[model samples]
Target: MFRLAHISDPHLGPLPEATAWQLANKRIFGYVNWRRNRKGVLTTDILDNLITDMQEHAPDHLAVTGDLVNLALPAEIANARRWLTSLGAPEDVSVIPGNHDAYVPNARMKAEEAWRPFMSGDIVHSGSLNFPYLRVRGKIAIIGVNSARATLPLMATGYFRKAQARALSKLLDDCKEEGLFRVVLIHHPPLKHSTHWHKRLIGASRFRKTLRKHGAELVLHGHTHLLTKAATEGPHGPIPVICVPSASQGLGSRSKPPARYNLFEIGGKDGNWQCRLIERGYSTEDKVISELGNQMLSVPNA
Candidate 1:
C-alpha cells in the first residue's frame, strides 16, 4: 500500500501576453483574476474535469504542489506542460516550484524551459544545492524543494535555501531509517503557523529548525491556495503539514471549498508506520467528475 496523490495550484491560464510581473499582481491576477471575480479562468473545461478525476484515481505516486502557471508564462509554462502530460507517464508525476514559478530572478532557467516537456525523464538537476532535489522510489523518498524565488514587486515571499536546508539534512539522513517514507515536497509553507506577514515562508524559523533536525514524516505543501492545517514537532514525530487546493482555478475562488486532491496510503505497520487520507469524490452527473473509493479513509491522521 504505497499510493499518494496530492495536486495543487494549477493556475494554467488563457495567456495572451502578460509580462510576468506575476501577471500584474492583483494577488496574482491569473487570467486577469478570472475576469474580475470567479469563473474558472483558463478552462480546458476545468482541466478536463481534473484529468477525468485523475484517471479515475489511479494514484501510485503524483504530487504537484505548486502553481503550475499563471504568469511565468512562456505560454503559461507551455500550458503547464500540457497539464503535466495529461496526468500520467512523467514517471507517475511529482513536481515542485510554486510562488508563481519563480517570476524571473533568472526564473530558474524559465522553470527548466516550461518544465522540460512534462519533466522529461524526471528532471533532477542536482547542482548540489540549487533548488534542493532528490528523488528515490523503492520505499519512497521524494524531496523536491525550490520555493520559487524572485520577489519584491508586491512581495509574495518564500525561501527554504540554507543550502536547501542542508540538502534537506542529507536527504533525511540517507533515507532508510528502517522504514523509508520520507516525502518532503515543498512549494512554500514550511511553517508560519498558517502563513501571513505578507505571505510568509521567508526562512520560516530556518525551516522549523530543519524540520526539527531531519525527521520528516511527511511535509507536503502547496502555497496557501487553501486547505491548510499545520504541525511541526518533528524528530520523527508529529509532522503532518499537508495542504491541497487549486487544481485548476484562475479564480473560481476557494479558500478551501472544493478543488481537492490529497490521497496517501503508506504501509509498514506492526513495526510502526502507517498513513491515510484517500478521500477523492466529485460527481457532476453528465458533466461527469467521478472518483469514489480507492480504499476509502476520508481523513484520519493526527
Candidate 2:
C-alpha cells in the first residue's frame, strides 16, 4: 500500500525581528496577535518533537497544507524553509499555502519564491509553476491548488476561481484515464456552513462543481484546525474530505486543537480500492504522536 501523510498550519513562531516597514501594513495586526496570543500557545519544541515522531512512520509522500509561518515575517519564512528541509526533500513533499502565509498583499509571492521547489508541479508544461500542480508517485496522483491569498482584516477565506477550477477539472479527467488514485490538496476545508463566514472558502460551490464534473478519489484540507471528515458529491459517489489539526499546537490552548496528522493507506485496482485512514497525533500527557483513529474508507464502485 502507498502511504500518504497530511499535516497543516505549522504557524512556526517566536516573531522574527521585523522592520517597521514590514509591520506597517496588515502584518501589524498579525504581529500583535502573535505577541498577545500565538507566541504563548505555539511552542517551537512541540512542533519539533511532532515532526521527529512523524518521520518514524515514514510516509511515502507528505502533504503540508500551508500556514508554515506566522505574520509572514522574513525570519519566520526562513525558519519554515529550514523546517521543510528537515522534513524531506522538495520532491517528496507537496505543499499549498494557507491564509496566514499570505497574511498581507504580495507576501504570498515571497513565500512562493522561498518555497518554489516544494510547491512546484512535477512537470512544467508551460515552463513555469501553476496550479493545480500534478505529481504522480507510484499509483497515486497528487494535485495541489493554491488557495492562499491576502484578504481584508479579520478575513481568512480561500478561493478556487473559475480558471483554476476548469484546469483542475481537466486534470482530474486525465488522471481518471490513467487509473491513478487522485487526491486534491488545498489549505481551506471548503465545507459549506461549517466554518465562520469570515473564514469560509469563497468559491467552494465552484470547486465542488468541478469535483462533481471530473471526480476524484479523495480531497484533503487543513484550515479548520480540527480532525474532521466531510463529503461532497462526485460523479462516482461521495468523495471523502479529510482535515487535520495544527501540527505544532500545544495542549494549553483551549481555542486550538492538539497536534496531529493523517495517514492514508491506498492500494488496489481501477474497479476496487482498499484504503485505510489513520489519525496519529501528540498529546500533552504522552508527548508522542500515537494512533488516534483508524477508518476504512468506502471503496468506490467502478
Candidate 3:
C-alpha cells in the first residue's frame, strides 16, 4: 500500500520582523491579520510537534497543499524553505503554493526560487515553472496544479487559467492511459461552494469539467482551514474531494481545533483501486496525535 499523508495551511507564524517598506502594500493588511488573529492560533512549536507526529506513521510520501508562510516576508520565505527541507527530501514530498505565498506582487517569484526543489516536476518547462506537472511514484501519478497568484487586497482567490486547465485535462487523460492512480493536488478546492466568494478558485467550472470528462481516483486540497469532504461527478462515479484543517491550529481556553492531517493507504489495480483514509488530529487533552475517524474512501470503481 502507498501511504500518502496530506496536510495544509500551516500558515507558519511569528511573522518574522517586517520592514516598513515590506509592509507597504497588501502585506500591511496581512501583517495586521497575523498579529490580531493568526498569531495566537498558530505557532511554530505546534507545527513542529505535528510534523513529528505525522512522520511517526511512516508515510511513503507527503503532500503539502499550501500556505507555508504568512505575509510573504523575506525571512518568512527563507524559513519556509528550511521547514520544507526538514520535512523530507524533494522527491519524497510534493507542494503547491497558496495565496499567501503570492501575497505581494513579486513575492511569488521569490517563493519560486526558495521552493523550486519541492515544486519542480519531472518534465521541465522553459523560463518559469508550469502547472499540471507530474511525479510518478509506484503506480500513483501525483499531479500538481498552481492556482496561487497575486490578487488585490482582501482577496485570496486562486486562478486556473484557460492554458493550465487545458494542460491538466491532457495530463489526466495521459495518466488514465497509463493506468495510474491519479491524485490531483491544489491549494484551493475545485468546487464553487468550497470557499467564500473572496477566496474562491476562479474557473472552477472548467476544472470540474476536465475531471468530469477524464476522471481521477482522488482530489486533495486546502485553503478553507476546515475539515471537509465533498464529491464531484466524474465519468465513472463521484470523485472524493478531501480537505484538511490548518496544520498548526492550537486549542486554547476557547481556541479552535488542534492541528490535523489525513493518511491515505492506497492499493489495488488502476480501475479497481482501494483507499483507506484515516483522519488524525492532535488531542490537546491527551497531548498526542490520535485517529479522529477511519473510513474507506470511494475509489473510482470500487
Candidate 4:
C-alpha cells in the first residue's frame, strides 16, 4: 500500500515581513478574509498544528501542490524551503510551483535556488522548457509541471508554455507504455471555471485529451484555495481531481473550517486497484492531534 499526503497553499513565511509584496496587493482584504474565515486563530499556531498532524500520519510520500510562499520573494521562498525541509527531505516529497510562486519575473530561478537543498531530481535546463518533469518513486511516477508563469500586471494569470504542453503529452505517452501509476501535479486546474481565462490552465483541453489518450490515474492540484472535486474522462476511467484546503488562512474560527490536508492511499485491493481520500485536519478541541476521515475514489474500467 502506498500512502501519499496532499497539502497545498501553505503560504508559509515570517509573516507580513517576508511577503511585503502580497501585503501591498489591492486584494489585501483577502488576507483579512483568511484571518477571519480560516486558520488565523493564533501565532505560529497553524504551522504547529500542520507539523504535528503530518508527523503523526507519516505518509509514504508528501506531495505539496504549491503556493509554499506568499509572494515568491527570495526571503519567502527561503522560509518556504525551511518549512518543507522540516516536513521531510525532497526524496520523501514532491513539489510544484503555484501562481504565487511565479509572481516574480525570476520566479522559476528563485524557486530552483531556494529549494535546491530539498530537490531529489535534476533540474531540467532545456531552453523554453520548464515542465513535464518526472519524479519516479517505486511503481508510481509523479509528473511535476510548472503551470505558473510570469504575466502582466493586468493579467494576474498563469500559463504553461506551448513547448511545456507538448512535452507533457510526450511524457504521458511514454509513461503509459511503462504501466506506471501517473500522477500529474500542477497548481492550476485544467478545467476552466470561476478563474479568469488568462489565469486558467490555457491548454487544459489538450492536456486532458492527452491524459485520456495516454491514461493517468490521478491529477492533483491546488490554487483555488477552496475544496473542489471533479473527474475527467480518461481511457481507463474517470480520473479523480482533488483540490485541498489551505494550510494557513488567518484564524481558526467557527465560521470557517480550520486548516486541513488530504491523505491518499493507493494500493491493491482484492486484485484490483484502490485509491482513497482521507480528509485530515487539526481539531481545535484536541489542539495536539490531527483529525481524519476516509473517502474512496471510484474509477471505472473502460
TM-score of every prediction relative to native: 0.34, 0.96, 0.96, 0.83
Write down the lDDT of every candidate, Cα atoms only. Answer: 0.66, 0.86, 0.88, 0.70
**lDDT-superior candidate, 1 or 4:** 4
lDDT tens digits, residue span 183-274, model 1: 78888787756777766888878878887876767788887766665678766456777787666543333344446577888876323567
Which parts of model 1 have CA positions greater than 4 angstroms off? 1-5, 10-64, 68-101, 104-144, 147-169, 178-180, 186-258, 269-279, 284-302
Residue 105 of model 2: what lDDT? Answer: 87
lDDT of 3 by residue, 200-220 (tens): 999899889988998999999
Ranking by lDDT: 3, 2, 4, 1
TM-score of 4: 0.83
lDDT of 2 by residue, 59-97 (tens): 999999999988887787778888889899999999988
Q: CA shift at 142, candidate 4, in angstroms?
A: 0.8
Report clash pairs, candidate 4: 35-250, 38-251, 39-250, 39-251, 40-250, 40-251, 40-252, 41-251, 41-252
